[model samples]
Target: MNPARRTTITSAAVLAVTGGLLTTTAAPASAATTCTSPVFKRQFFANTTFSGTPKKTDCDTTIDQNWGTSAPTSGLPSNNFGVRWSVTRDFGSGGPFSLAVSGLDGIRVYVDGVRKIDLWKNTSTTVSKTVNVTIPSGSHALRVDYVNWTGSAKVKFAYTPRTSATVDTVKPLVPTGTSVSYDAATGKAKLTWSKNKEMDLAGYRVYRRLKGTSFGSTPLTTTTGTSYTDTPPPTGETYYYEIRAYDKADNVSGGTADQGVTTVDRTGPAAPTGLSAHGDLDGMVLGWDAVSGAVGYEVFEKDAATGSYTLLKSLTGTSYLHYVGHNETLHTYVVRSLDALGNPGPYSAPVTSDGIDRTAPPAPFDLAVSTDSGDVRVNWKTPEEHTRDELDNYGRFTVYRSVGSTLGADAERLDCDYSTTLDSANDVYSFGCVDPTWAYATTYTYAVTFTDWQGNESAPSETVTVTTADGLPPAPVTGLTATPRADGVLLRWNASTDADIDHYWAARGVRQADGSFKATDPCTRSTTDPLTALCIGIPDGETAAYAVYAVDKWGNASEWTIVDATELTITPGEPIGADSGALWGGGGWTMPGQGGNVQWHCEGAVCADVTEYRVSRWNTETQTYDLLGTVAPKDGVYYQSYTDATMPLGSISYYRVVGVLSDGTETVAAHPWQIRPDLV
Candidate 1:
């Protein structure tokens, strides 16, 4: 036979396609005696579909062939023919193999006589596929096939082995060189690597990690160029980087070793705020709100606006006291915050002062003392000598308490912020500090002096002494009386007989199961304030009872003495009808912690079943009623009363009584009572 006829006969003996794109079936074939490794049997068909019979066939040594814009073989068919080639060859070992097959039209592959891949279609582009297969450990039939439908006829079939699917299976013969550089001023890192010695190298990817954190997901950047500049990160943070190379086929190589770069802290901290300057007799006192991340503060002073400010002092505190050692009168000052690296931030708004300060604060006087068993309260008013400017320049006071009447260096010292104490029970007009170490029945003397911001100390004030009370509790309250009132119940009790009793506590109980009373909170009233001796309007009914305890100066309390007032009742009516007229004036000890007493009475038939009563105290600041305490109706008593010693001080305190029924409702007072509080 001729070479063309032999080729056609060889091709016709291998494959016969009936329909579909290159669907193959076993055809007549004979064993090839001229076979070699990586060699394949080539077959050609007449139709675009791999149907009918092949026209030509031959043995091909390799699959890397480019047949130009022509038919693959000349016989009976035109340019459209679905062809396939196959050969039984040993794979040495089979784990993961990449089979690269591409051509102008279409291609497919078969392993061990089984179709393994199919890209069978008409096309002008090349296509490839990689698959992992096992062929035992030895010889297996390998097939690389293609067909030319139209256009340029080109095909390539090649492969390389890989250990696994997701790892790089190819290594370059030549190694690559890499370098890194960082700019401290800009905090930017630039990475450069030598080009990979691979013809198929596609690009390089850069990865970075913070100093102590793991490398993040995804690469920092991907580029075909050899160099890349990274976006600058936070200051003072050190970062590490690495790179990897990949081919156009997406097979990656092992990453290069990591490199590290430490970025410098080039940014300074924010400026300070709320700056204030006060001229003192000695110097100026400068203070401001603390800056968040500042290590220190820098003070700058300038004589004129045209000139730049010169650094004066560095302070670790938020405030600075500039001593007037020189006669620099017309001075302007600005403050700046400094980072740990000694970088100064933007300056504060400048403050200009006219003259030097040399005046010392006047002596603080009129120091009074209130003594308990273990503590002595030293209260003093703001000195009249404390002028407006002096108070503005006030830093703090150095308090001294000597055991005797004379002031001495061995006296105990303390520091104070404000000049008066508003929360003290005794005096709202004076600032007080407590000495918890004072002994009972002992005499103590105290003295106070004043100082300015520049440390100019005034002479000591006149000394005062106080004798502490002995540790003894007061007597129990007695002589109880109850009356029915319009709002609730009215109660009255005689003062405790004990001389040392400074206050009284009245406790009320709500009638519970089995004829027992569940006690509520105890209300307090000072005994030294005579207007609070007889409480008038309490918000309880016949179901409640009352008891009173006497408390002494040392916080000692006596046993509770119950007042049987269950028989009392109140009839709800107009406001201020009962217990409304307090004979004492409003300001003289007429407030909570220093004021009046109340008694509640309920007269309704349901009063016997009353649970508790809620008393409302007016918040002088908010002008709204706040629930002070809930008292149970006093059982078997005609009327009941309670004393309140402390609501919020520093304003007029108002009180109202409301009877609580079993249904969780109230019979409220017509209006709340009013009194002026004397304590903070």
Candidate 2:
């Protein structure tokens, strides 16, 4: 018998085609070989009947291959043979699908053993048919059978999900078996889940949110794989995640259970704002708006425009007071908030201010007391006369007189019967006042001070004591002469005849519109130099008279001997000097200390030429370096200090220093110093 003729007899008995349907009496064949689910288990039969799969068996991932007029595998007949492909798989959330089959002789398809596509007939040309079907969810079986009876043989079959939005509306199944792992060191969260079984599944979406917040509409990521790695904000917050599956048709499944993670807090609180500074007699007062999550605030201070901001203080309140003692130097300030975890936020805007004036001038010194009949004269040296430093903001002199032996706070403040004299011979500026209400034989104590325009008074000068005498006063000064010199009127007289004469008192006064003589201030000269006396700082162009009297060792006084002087003018000369710049380490701190500090070295010629250095702080709002104060150069001091105890903290600050010559010439620095306290 011929090889093809043998199959023709068996095919005729086992199969028949009528009305585009296949009728098969062939028994189902069971294979000993196995294939993984979702992969087609293929079996070849020698006869058209698929009974007893002894010819060949294998696995195929898909059924779209074309076996053209030849055996699909070795030892299989090219004609008069049959091939069967079967698979059982999960069609999760199953939906509409397309079944396509084409073949020359015959082809058929069955879903779960129910026939769906039938084009079974021996033909010379290839026959094609496509059918739509719905597959239920869960495990189900599919089978494709092809038979070649005679002529050229070829077979092709395909099964695909219908993914068009108008055609398939079914969603993918929710992912399951979700788990997560976290790496604290790298701050990474990795999530994994079982892949969805839907053939139309597009991908999975991962969502994350803070623990207390709801998940956002947008997904964090979308991936086709079963695992994903994410990086959440490392602000030491608790966060949650959810997984969802979506289909190619844009249908999405419900989200899985929320997964949670706690991350390490590496973020700081927000910076405080609305920072403000105010000057008061107490100190520099700083305040700012409180931050939402802050537990405390740190105040930093520096000299305005001149040094690095130092940590002034840390407190839980929104306000702070920077105690700077008796100095009213302008300072710059910044503030930062701290979280409970001690993380610090950015600094606030810089603020500059010079605190209210609370500083007083040095006290007057060299107090002397003398007495005349019916009056007592008090004399003291001005602070400028002793120190010769610039008497800044000098207002006037205050003389206190006490009737008791000891001077105390209750001492009487005398009226403005004051006078200032520059004695050229003695090179001293003296102030004197005569308590004309005095009585004879009375003891008195006197003290004086220099006061600023603000009425801030210096410490009292050393006290002077004297007692009026009971006996008669010395004879009046004889041969009284008044000479007008450049500085003041020079008075000359013969020595007093009384041996007990202690000192002579001279009073100068401007004649008022009334003819009565009004004493300005009484000057005192001891008996050791009673012949001559000089009155200093008597203004020019004034008709003035001088009266001289004698005081005994017991404070007795003689009657006045008057001498009038001609008008004279004393003119001041023009100041002169050259610019001597204040040089330093680029305006930065030369040494470590409290608050912000700026140091400069100016010795030799430059130090000798410049009178003082002015320090300033940068003011952002004003766009200028506001002056803090002046620093004078010492004769032998090479390094000068510009320290700002109230520097801005948690911010970058700028500082500058300029030198001033005696003639009012200014020398500026090459560049302003930049200090980043936050970075440090």
What are the lDDT scores of the predictions, listed in order?
0.61, 0.71
Candidate 2 to truth, TM: 0.35
Residues 300-342, candidate 2, lDDT per residue (tens digit)?
8865556678998889999887776446566789999887668
Report the lDDT tens digits of candidate 1 across residue range 431-514. 668775666677667887767766778777778887787776666667755444322233457877777666666656665566
What would the TM-score be for candidate 1 when compared with the true structure? 0.25
**lDDT, residue 623, candidate 2:** 68
TM-score of each: 0.25, 0.35
lDDT agreement of model 1 with the native: 0.61
